[model samples]
Target: MLIRQLEYLVALGREQHFGRAAAVCYVSQPALSAAIRKLENELDVTIVLRGRRFEGFTDEGRRVVGWAHRILAERDALLADLDRMRNGLRATVRIGAIPTAVPATPLMSSLFSTRYPLARVRIESLSSREISRRLAEFELDAGVTYLDNDTPPGTRSVELYRERYRLLVPADDELARESVVEWAAAAALPHCALMSTMRNRRVLDANMAAAGATLVPVVETDTVGALYAHIATRRLASIVAHTWLHAFGVPEGMCVRPLAEVRPRPAVGLIVSDREPTSIVVDALVDALSGADLSEALERSLPPVIPG
Candidate 1:
């Protein structure tokens, strides 16, 4: 049977109505019905349980529908593979990243663009757990996330950088005068923090607990820029990724100090599936990371801005 017939079958199973399924398939009702009938004839089985209207699939038809899903998915993947091979990594490469790692996306995109200037690079800000789920389902080409978290099976993670927390404070703030701030001391200040839903927020929370500090943030937000805003006004302080200061300078009037004596830093890195015959785009993206030290690279690229 043709793939169209299989599509018709899948649509029928999903919609559970002949006219509706035909509409979804963008074909006449009779044409869809004829295709599936031909499918049933070739297989020598009654595929659908029919009445005046579409009933449901029989046991055998259900099995065929399951196979159809896998076959269609594979078919699309094969076409994508062939296109990439012919186009030389020109297809859109979708990369998901945790919010804290977003600053690194522009660097990766710039690297990928050098070899394939025409290629489209899409970067999405997502949670670590959400990135893992999307990676497992093949919805995302790669992910930039904490490599130490529970990784999905069949996915490989390559550490790109060790992410450390930094305390951001106003320039005139007494704490900002210090070159290094202890975790307990930083956590004790009246500060704005990332919302509890963020993975980095959890990491900071654990670090505070381990440092025997009580963290009662005066304001909580989901975005780093908001925290920076509060701290910029000199009304509050914040803890944020050290790397973030590279792409984005510490807000005007604010300074950053490295957090000290905290728990071990987590490694944030690139994650892709280990499934054989990886997509060329994925391969190229990984290759772009070769010999790149995220921390050092960022430091060299953006010299210490004087909080401008």
Candidate 2:
């Protein structure tokens, strides 16, 4: 029997009405009925209960419906497996990363390419929350996000590096001369910027509050790029994770300093679903990220910024 007929049977079982099932399947009721009849004839079994209206499947049909689901799932897996072998390492490895982790993408990409030599990687900017959701849905093969705090359930994690917060300000700013800025002192500065959705911001906020001050960011943005851009224009001073500077070139006449008060720096890492299988390309990317020395790689890939 045709797979379409099997699909029609499964839809009929779910919808429990010919009209509704046909509507879901985007076909006329008669067409669905005819397909089911053909299927029954080929199998030489009474698959459906006949009545004035559509009814539930027969016992034989019910068993067959279960088999159909399994069969279809296997069919899809087969196709994916065949495609992978045929294409070698050329398949797209869809990845999601937090704003702070954006800078680390190219180094990871370069290392992955050196290993696979043929794989193509697509990296998307995503928040930690969205990254977990996409991974659960199997839309993303892997994601780069906070390793400990924001990670969701049932995912394999790979620790990459610890991201320490640092201050980015104009070179001529009053606070620039200090070896390090206290969280309390930085909050009192004019025009401080924050990334509203990031866990990094939450950490900064908590640190500032602990230091007997609360942040009142003159600029709040979703992306670190925007925060950096504003700092470049001399509009704001921002507390940024060290990883971001690895990705983007800093503006002229800017300075950076480690935030001494915010101790026990947070860790950043990769997360992949435990339920979903990692494609070859994804494995290569993971190997590259886990195997390389991120601090040294960042130094080589990125222009020198004021060291934190």
Ten contiguous residues minimizing lDDT sum, candidate 2:
299-308
Residue range 1-308, candidate 1, lDDT tens digits: 79999899988987899999999999999999999999999999899999999989899988888777656656656776687678655578889988888888887888789867767899999887888766655567899988774666678777788876677777787887676788888876888988988878888889888889877899998887777677777568788777777767677767777778454678888999787666667777888876677777876754352332
The CA lDDT at 185 in model 1 is 82
- Report the Cα lDDT for candidate 1: 0.79
* Residue pairs in clash, model 2: none
Cα RMSD (angstroms) for every candidate in the order listed: 5.3, 7.5
- For model 1 the TM-score comes to 0.75
Task: Evaluate model 2: give its lDDT.
Answer: 0.74
TM-score for each model? 0.75, 0.71
Return the top candidate by lDDT: 1
Q: In model 1, what are the clashing residue pairs, if there are any?
A: none
What clash count goes with each model?
0, 0
Residue-wise C-alpha lDDT for candidate 2, range 1-308, written one tens digit per residue:
78788778878876889999999999999999999999888888888998898667789987777677555544544565577688756656789988778887777778777877776788999888889866654557799888775579888888777776667777788788788788888887765565656677887877887899988888787777778778888657777766776666556777776667556767778887765344454565677777567766654644444533
